[model samples]
Target: MRKLTDFEKQVIEQKGTERPYSGEYYQHDVKGVYCCKKCDAPLYRSESKFNAHCGWPAFDDEISGAVKRNIDADGRRVEIVCAECEGHLGHVFEGEFLTPKNVRHCVNSVSMVFKSALEVVAPVKKTELATFGGGCFWCTEAIFSTLEGVNSVVSGYAGGSATDANYRAVCSGMTSHAEVVHIEFDPDVISYESLLAVFWQSHDPTTLNRQGNDSGPQYRSVVFIHSDKQAESVNAMINTLTKACVWQDPIVTEVAAFDGFYPAEDYHNDYFELNGEQPYCKIVVKPKVDKVKALFAELLKSN
Candidate 1:
């Protein structure tokens, strides 16, 4: 079980009441799921939440079998607790007519944690990994992070001879490391070919060892294929693009077998997002992000 603070223990274990309007989620209105703070078991959906004007978070219903009810110590009011861990979750009342359900679950915000719907992807038995280098890692990371099936994007160094690489070493153009974004995605939702299509459109793959004035081997356009299937797919894509005359210049993108990747520094992880106002991000990364959004609106995660 997760450890709880004194205040959380008071409300969740001791059945203590928090002051009205003092909870963090009293006025929260994000579309997502709320889970038990103690056990992480989903207890409510955001759609069931309604404005009760009672200075506490109110939900019209709870996830089936997630919340259990019992008579209060006074034998008058009904108390609700997490069915999994029996943690206190406040009370349930009916006949208020606040909504069609005519029920209100006056829950303590401290008892639950909200997970944004955009962050929750459907469960899959297996997930796939794809890595690519498209000039700046920041640009590729920002673009892929917006895709629905993409589970994660980590900025790193690959295609290098160095046993270990860092931003300073790679930027020096001596490490042979191309800045890359390692992506984990669900192939069932977004195909590898779809990712390649986005990649080809997001950056200039025809320019040799350069992307928008960033000239170095570190910024070279490349793809690291993890399997033979990926190799075949990428080769087919390259042939199709070549026949279609996608670019006036020949594509310089290097197709290489998967190699070890060394993650960049911590601050480099979400560069475009955390440093959007910075001139580099605004000038170099923002345009790629905007291009992906415009060209692949249907593949983006729902807000």
Candidate 2:
């Protein structure tokens, strides 16, 4: 079982309520699954959340069989708890008409933990890895993380020597390393070509060593292929995009052989999701994320 902080114990064990509008997830708007803090059971989808002006994170739905509801001891409110562990999750209210469902799940922010679609690392019987650098790993991570078949998208450095893989060295633009994501995916659910498509469409391959205000060798566009088959698929997709006149400028994206990928520092792995309110995430990552969510809606995992 996951260890709980004092605040979590208060709200989850003692059935406490966090101050309105103070919860971390109260205003969160990212695509991913929310799970029980105590048991890690899947609870809610980002799509089901809406602002109810009630100071708590409001949801209109929960993942099937993930939650159980019962009347509170006072017999005035319905309390929702994690089905697997019976962890306290606040209360559910109905007939509010706040959303199309006409129901609201008033959940404490501390009651659950969010697993952004980009950070899910579910183990599968079969899986494959694809590595690509398309500017900032934070943006790239956000884009690919939502895809249906992707198991996990890890932000890291590649196409560079191991000694200089650290973020500070890469940021200096002296190392050959480029910020990249190592994606673990299931080919049966999403093909390599589809991932490549997202890679190309989500960023400007035309820019040589920069993406918007960010410019450096570390931000260059590159695809590091893991196998001959991956190389062929990437080539074919680039050819198709070229034939369709997707960009006015010639694509400068380099297709390189798979090299060692050094996972980024711990804090950088889910920078965008964990630090969404930061200026960089709010200003740069969110817009790109919104675009990816819209363009690849069908590929996103359903909550």
Worst 10 contiguous positions by lDDT, candidate 1: 294-303
**TM agreement with the true structure for every prediction:** 0.60, 0.58
Candidate 2 Cα misplacement greater than 4 A, ranges? 1-124, 298-303
Distance from true position, residue 93, model 1, in Å?
12
Instruction: Give the whole-model CA lDDT for all candidates, comma-separated.
Output: 0.91, 0.91
Predict model 2's lDDT versus the native.
0.91
lDDT of 1 at 182: 96
Residue 29's C-alpha lDDT in candidate 2? 93
Error of 2 at 81 (Å): 28
Worst 10 residues of 2 by lDDT: 294-303
- Note each model's CA RMSD in angstroms: 14.2, 16.7
Q: Residue 47's C-alpha lDDT in candidate 2?
A: 89
How big is the positional error of residue 94 in model 2, measured in Å on the Cα after superposition?
35
List where candidate 1 sits over 4 angstroms from the true fold: 1-124, 162-164, 298-303
| Candidate 1: clashing residue pairs, number | 0
